[model samples]
Target: MGRRSSNKQQGGGGSEVAPVRLHIDPERPAPRKLEPAITALRRGHVIVYPTDTGYAFGCAISSPRGIAMLRRLKNMGERDPKPLTMLVGSLADIGRYGHMGNAAFRIVRRLLPGPYTMVVRATSEVPRGMKNKRQEVGVRVPDHPVCALLGELLGEPLLTASVTHFEDEQFELQEPEEILRRHARELSVVVDVGPLWPDPSTVLRFLDDEMEVLREGKGPVPD
Candidate 1:
């Protein structure tokens, strides 16, 4: 019973489908554990992992395989466009991924380092999951360390995918270990480095100096 081996409940799905899972983790970043989590993503598995804002279900943002797996598990409609959010390791990547300005900076300045999602233009490397109905994408740089570390280790932005396990769940997990085991085989890895926020990031669309509230929870948007 190594920490890396979480319990993966066999979710019910079509015989040909792989069940999506949720994972919890220990309080340390064991390379042994992280490697499995990363492997899960590399293999196209959908996962429920913790982030700065809360516990989000996500996949490797650049992997179509991971995105498709999430789309199937989410039972999203064709017209849904499969939009997802990118969790960048730092503020620098936001420019590489989207066009930003003083306005975008101000908006991000207040809400970020916490729970907030900013919609921006899609770069060539962005995953299809983040694209809008017409190909736009959302990006976030969380104030949490574990998430940032994971992004750095992966050498890419993280995809903030959604899950419905808990009703109105915030940006943190209470029983991460159990969660990890519940979705063991289905997850990339579970990293519970330390304490984390228990809410989701404030979500906003910032483009051309305008702002729109996609979701009104966690961090609030100013008028």
Candidate 2:
């Protein structure tokens, strides 16, 4: 594991504006070596890391600044009002932030630790901004191990959103090198697990007894 932090002050205000880059094995990222990334999240910094689908932006769920920065990076409008997704380490972690009934839980249990984003009713613990008017939230448990360890160490779900190449809506970016070049000033840390294949997690919405497919991406919708 390699940790590189940029501490150059921005403008005359003496605010440091450099992003840290960490290259770790996607299979099993050592917890001790990931302390720097944890520290960045603790300080409300945005991180770019690989997932089962592709590279995505992440930050502490409790950080308003981090959330606002992510929205800005993605060019989300001031009143865009779209709910962001939550990334957790395991199936058990989902209940902490969202409400999953028996049907929903059983359905989620079959597909998680793979490429899928399931929408469930949000609990009060989830930040309001990350929930829609109906208080439903999108959650994911990526197949990648680094993010699982990250969520475990951080002790909470992370705010997650996909990253694109230079405002290109047609593609999702997977190259860490390109992310470093394009988003260095905007991010606090970039986790490099090499180039992942580009794809987006399939999105599903579960409202009470009803289940609906919101977006058809990488994962197959459960029949």
The prediction achieving the highest lDDT against the true structure is 2
Model 1, 2-102: lDDT tens per residue? 24233334322112333332233433444544555565666655566676555666677777766666666566554675356778876778878876678
Output the lDDT of residue 98, model 1. 72
Best by TM-score: 2
lDDT of 1 at 27: 39
Off by over 4 Å in 1: 4-33, 165-188, 192-198
Looking at candidate 1, the ten consecutive residues that score lowest on lDDT are 13-22
lDDT of 2 at 164: 57
Off by over 4 Å in 2: 1-14, 165-169
Query: Clashing pairs in model 2?
Result: none
Cα RMSD, model 2: 2.9
- Cα misplacement distance, residue 90 of candidate 1 (Å): 1.1
